[model samples]
Target chain A: MKLFKDAGHLFRLAGVFLLGTLSFLAIRAFVVPHSFGQYGHYRGAAIAEIAAHPVHFAGHQTCETCHSDIAQTKSAGKHAQVNCEACHGPLAKHADDPSIDPGKPDVAVLCVRCHSASAARPKDFPQVDADQHSGGIPCTTCHQPHNPVIAAGGAK
Target chain B: MPGVEGFMYPNEISLYWSVLIVLYPFITGLVAGAFILASLERVFRVEAVRPTYRLALLTALAFLLVAPLPLQLHLGHPERSLEMYMTPHRTSAMAMFGFVYLWYLMAVLTVEIWLDYRADIVALSNSTTGWRRWLYRILTLGSQNVSERALHIDERVGWLITLIGIPSAFLLHGYVGFIFGSIKANPWWSSPLMPVVFIFSAMVSGIAAVMLLYMVLMRLRRQPIDMSCVDTIAQYLLYIFIIDFSLEMLDLIHRIYEADESFRSLDFMVHTRLWLSQVVLQICIGTLTPILLLFLVQVTKLSVPVRKRIYVVSGSLALIGIFAMRWNVVIGGQLFSKSFLGYTTYKMALATREGLLVSIALTILPLVILWVLVKLLPPWPEKRHAPLPAALAAD
Candidate 1:
């Protein structure tokens, strides 16, 4: 009590600080999402909200359903493991309605997304200098999108 | 893939932390540095530096006010930043920023500055009229008593705050360093020396900034520049710069000797992409040249005019060096792919949100704030008691 009397102004300052801090903490407690940090660092409900979003990219199995011939050709090629939608944009809408063909891809752009020469890429991967190799021609002009081996002058 | 030079991870294609992130540390560094310079006079009893004591505090307050702006601007949901305080992740280093920033702002800087200016504020409140009087009155926080005993208490409390402020300043900037250093993914940023380098560099930049401001302000006000004060500050700047340079060199040497898996990739980057910014500008033009110029001043008996020129040149260069250091740490850390396979480029947009224009604006914002703070507080002692009240005039 004597300490407070001697330094009442300091106490007032401290009191102001405490009041501000408590107010901040109270407001924080009120506004923070209830389900946050339930499992990890973020709101758990966010995961559910994200999952609830409509699927955009229809999977390879769905692509295989309608275009079985292309799927068989792709299966026999070097890009057998590559998914159909990896080169083509999300096709869930096109998959549901066959009347709307997803249309031909920008073959040069799609090919170089993976094949662009980079030291970081795996050595055995089919890399290319798009400008030098193709000379302004589309990738689909020579190499078939589904069967790359046959069009690259390899065994069919 | 278009802007990318080499193989980058799919996610690394777009840089998450932009130029605004670089400004965050640079601004915070200035705040921490200015406060530490203020502490030299208050706590360390450096009488020669008394001229800069109040100005340093106000400069710190101005920059500190703007310190979090860049971070806020950089956030995807700037409004949601309040969640940091509300539901802070206990395990994350970034989460501690809110508490640290708050404590420094409220408990340390604001309180210390208020106590230091309480008597002046009370006097101003009584002397001024209309809005000015009310402004000072509100500023006094209803504690109008400026008795000798009250002032003595204020002095003691202010001294204690300055003592605490030194370490808090260290924590404020060192924590910024740790945010980058603790990221185990990037070898460029993940070094133990990062925090130490940051603290020393903050000291260098802050001292240099205050020194330059003091000279420029004195020239503007038509007051004679204090050579002793500038000399003392330059001495401190040189010493801290030496330590900062040494620590950075140590980090470099360790990396070179170890030649870790990330070494080849980083080495390539330093040789190619970072050659201009890191090597020529930061090291040669900014760091070494300033250190040499300041060193010459220390050894020689040059005229005041020559010494002043040296101080200005060196101070400007030190600031540029430290800014470059922040640039290297923040931007350079992101330039290289985590896979160590390729590198990417940062094409700073002109007028966009995190563009060069916004960065320039943010950089100048603190100076404008300091101008306002200096106008309101009038940090110079000669200007402090211009309108003293009669009752307090006797003391």
Candidate 2:
């Protein structure tokens, strides 16, 4: 009580610190099951129910087996640093239901979640405004999911 | 598709946020302009502008206070912005913005206002009680002694500060131009004349802002219209606007003459990316129209009523013009891809915290600061028993 009263208007600082500490602890507490596969049976059961297959898709090697062109394009594009599933979400379904209609994810949402508020992004990289992009140009018009490079990165 | 040599030399155009960062000085230009309008009356004995002088100073100071907010919003971690001060580097022009902001705030605006209103402070100090008294007391800085000699000294010091601040004003806004101009990467932004163009435009915007606010304040207070003051302000606005327009034309001429490899791309960006802001709003509506109206009023010896109306239209246009210029420099620069082959648009979302809300906050923060400043040192002198004669009042 004394500390709270003396804190005056420093409540924001205290709250940020408290939230950070709690998040750290929560991450640590949840890590045990994730690393050990202690709940592997439940996870497999859930995956089977949802995706109808539990085959592990280990990175690009799993992706290249089926779609070599996209893999090659991905490697050549600016998105080489990113994994296919990073944007495509879980690809387990794509492998399982051959007729699941793998329509693209809303590209604007996937891109702007990082690009607009980005810090270390390259200079002259276009910023996506929610209202404008939501209105006129759709995401795929400017960006390609399989291949996203600004003129093949030769654009100094 | 694999091989290409048409790829431009020195390719990195600018950072996404660097464009927005440039807008900081553009806003500061408005501040410098408004402050100079005030100085014309306060320090330079331009009695015809006395009506709007105090209001102009307040407006300048108000905008100056908030000029950094947009830059802060553009930054990834605004909290880390203070590091610019702790870790100042010589090569980075932006690293010096902190110093420029401080010099303008502390040495220019704060000191100028306080010194200019010392006479009023001593009077207000004795009249108010409690917190107001304490506020006035602190503002006075233990100087209750406002004798004839002290008043004279204050005036002298105020004049000196105003003189010194002119270059600082130039630096504050001009340095922003320097940042853009210094960039060898973007042929669009890179120009030796960018600073000159920015400074003149700052003057234009500043004058227009003061003219508008002065008219508004008088209407609110129900004070009689000061035609002489308005006319004088209008004249100064015309001068600055003419110079600013000329400089812009010069910049365009140079670009046309050079016709470098990047010309086609830049010209395309200007037409498409900045068409509305640069051509329609800035050039046609804001500049030419205002200049035409001002010329009609000043040259034709129009009626007082007609001139006043013209001032209203012209001043508003000038203000809008300056803002459009800023938008062109800040938002427009980022539209063109470094590849110079493609262009993109910036979309501002309405519902987000970082969108228009932060801009509103930036605009509002200055008014709050002004209110606090006026509370600390009322810009106008309090009506007193031994007030100076009406003749001296003209001073």
Each candidate: RMSD: 4.7, 14.2
* Weakest lDDT window of 10 consecutive positions for candidate 1 chain B: B386-395
Considering every candidate listed, which one attains the maximal lDDT?
Answer: 1
Give the range of the ten consecutive residues with the poorest summed lDDT in model 2 chain A: A5-14
Alpha carbon lDDT of each predicted model: 0.87, 0.72
Give me the chain B TM-score of candidate 1.
Answer: 0.96
lDDT, candidate 2, A1-156, per-residue tens: 644443322243335447856985676466423433335422334544678756544466676788888788778766777877787766766667547665778865777876663333566775656566557566566556566554654222
Where is model 1 more than 4 Å wrong at Cα?
Answer: A1-6, A44-156, B1-16, B337-343, B385-395
